[model samples]
Target: MLGRLNHVGVATPSIDDAVARYRDVLGATQIGEAFDLPAQGVRVCFVDTPNSQIELLEPLGPESPIAKFLEKNPLGGQHHVCFEVPDIHAAKAELEGKGVRILGEPRIGAHGTPVIFAHPRDMGGMLTEFMETPREGAH
Candidate 1:
């Protein structure tokens, strides 16, 4: 099943603005640099916290999934919450056995580990992402 809360994905129209807010206003110090995740169609950055991290996602293009999300809320907002799993495959099977509808096949995530998303409906409105735990020294 789920291990610990990994990171919360926040969709933003601008990753730079989000990063500034988290750093200046929110007083977050361990912010990571923004980078392109072309495969996910997003420009991402991470703000590390004591317990978990905050992932800032900005659409890479008009057709990016986050762009559609931005259309609904121009300012952008919380998109999804990711939790770590010891074994993603087993967790997927367990969730599926309990009738949860996963969104797609397991794929490499921003953390460089396999990930899968459970449907929002099954997760009670908020999209849920499951990421396999990274090995030592890995993100």
Candidate 2:
């Protein structure tokens, strides 16, 4: 139902500082350019690792979900983990059949693929995102 672990989403107060931390501190050199997802109400950057990627998300407005997360954890932390799926709608139906609670309807994700989030409560306290595999060259 799921492919490789796509990325680990980390909420941050500043994407710039987060990128710097990954570069100067972790010696990461494959950080993707930060971009704003106004529709999602956040700015996002990707720090590519050998195995997977680290996604840095900074809320664009106080009403963003990330901002609400920051209210509980001022320092910000792991927001969610995303996995690639061949078909998002199929995967959603499969998960629903198994009684997993999806947070909302599928929508365009950061990677320009359809995605849906499974509720944390139903996912053993971990918010899980399933994103459809991108087309060739989409990355």
Give per-model TM-scores.
0.96, 0.97
- Tens-digit lDDT track for model 2 on 70-109? 9998888999999999999999999999999998899999
**TM-score of model 1 vs. true structure:** 0.96
Query: Cα lDDT of model 1 overall?
Result: 0.94
Against the true structure, candidate 2 reaches a TM-score of 0.97
Cα lDDT computed for each candidate against the true fold = 0.94, 0.94
Q: Write the per-residue lDDT of candidate 1 for residues 39-115, one digit (tens) a residue.
A: 88999999999999999999999999999999998998999999999988999999999999998899999989999
Candidate 2 Cα errors over 4 Å, as ranges: none
* Candidate 1 stretches greater than 4 Å from native: none
